[model samples]
Target: MPGNETTHPLLQRFHEGDPAALGELSDRFSPALMGFAGRLLHEPFLAGDIVQDVYIKLWQRKGEYDSIEGIRKFLFVATRNACINQNEKYRLRQGQPPSSEDADPDEAMRKLILSEYLGLIYQIVAAMPDKLQQVFYLSFEEGLSPEDIAQQLDIPRQTIKNRKVEVYKALREGLKHYKVAMPILLKMLFPH
Candidate 1:
């Protein structure tokens, strides 16, 4: 978990009580944390609140974590716990029996990993040029053929093919370290 210029390079500054570093951390992790909590609680509004609180807690415990890994772990765990607590309260308010089905630690962990990975992929895609982004969305997300995308965008079919290659290369470069999950992610992206 070495810090890169694009990712969590502010851990030391954060530990030293820098507000800008905390803001960067919030910007970096909030999306994945919100997605995890939203999936758990099925309420995006509550998820936002929970993620905000988790960041505040992180700021309070800044000295406790020496690395971004520690902060990442803390954010996920704290968000999950907060979501579970909120669910319990909702169940009680509704006069329903408490159920453990959604509280499975393994399932929650899987969702967290998936959300985080997807967030990274989205960040990579978002940084691409507008034309590349359009091609990527049409080809991968919409499962459009190169011919169809070229016709739709009024670009040459060969250009569509080339752009698709560029998108794949970008994704691979960004996600190269996650070797075990690469196949599954590629399968998802390249449905053809």
Candidate 2:
């Protein structure tokens, strides 16, 4: 019962050899993976190849994962490894020594953790109402002040503040399950 509790419908479908399920999983996770790989490798073309390879590897080992979280962990580790391998190869071609700093295990793990947090935040924001989503993006993503957002959206300053409070409440509620992660996220979002 405990084990099955964590089983996702997509994961079950994937285990049954459903190609569409794999595609759906790929669609869900690829953007985050691509962003991670692109930042790690600094080559968009190489990053694309790495993300594709990660999905292929996931499909190849489809039976190994029992939960969506497991699949996500596998994808992150595989993508990171592939990026490191590519960096090593590039270094070899350029006749440069392998950079030790590039292979810091903790750095990769930290990045993976941050990516997961951001992915969860994205999911929460996606489920928000359109007005709240717009306010959140403008205030947080676009770094606009409340006054700026109010001016741009032609709303009152008090209305912008109210919307921001709603956005914060929604985000905090969505993250309530992640007790350990919530504090870190809050600090990052409101470092003031």
Candidate 3:
């Protein structure tokens, strides 16, 4: 759903103007995009509106992307830019100046790129087998150490460590296309 291998066929169908493929893409990505926009704008209704606009734009420009990866990148980048514009408009309407803290263009671009890559990583993790997924979420999302995860999951500590190693291997293989180094992925996932 986040531009992994399974999505390649769907993306190919969409490029051929198949409405069902468009629907599939929308179903896969809309919720994540809504959450991303909501975080940026701090308004659930506005975020929904932005995500709707994104779908509309995607339909209108279906020929633009030959790969699911390209589509995924464009979807997030477009949603982010839309959210920034909407935030500025909302501020103007409330008689408040646009936030100067976020005015730096480079910082904004970095945040957008980070968010996109993180979304891809999340998709890969979600696709993992159940035990491995649980291990990874415990390690990263819950900020638990391998020992803590072993206790929580009623598994041996060594098994937990092994599962973590498997998770790293899976992530590295899945994200090879993005050129993400294992160390950076480890920092993002394990974050000590």
What lDDT score goes with residue 145 in model 2? 84
Report the Cα lDDT for candidate 2.
0.76
Better of 1 and 2 by TM-score: 2
Candidate 3: C-alpha lDDT: 0.77
- TM-score of every model? 0.57, 0.59, 0.60
| Residue 91 accuracy (lDDT) in model 2 | 85
lDDT of 3 by residue, 1-192 (tens): 454643578877887899999888886677557656765674547988898898889989998886776777788888888987888888889999886746798887677666666666666765678898788767876789888998999989999989988988888888788865669757876963
Instruction: Name the lDDT value of residue 51 in candidate 1.
Output: 87
**Model 2: residues with Cα > 4 Å off, grouped in runs:** 1-7, 102-192
If both were scored by TM-score, which would come out higher, candidate 1 or candidate 3?
Answer: 3
**Which pairs, if any, clash in model 1?**
none
Estimate every model's Cα lDDT from 0 to 1: 0.77, 0.76, 0.77
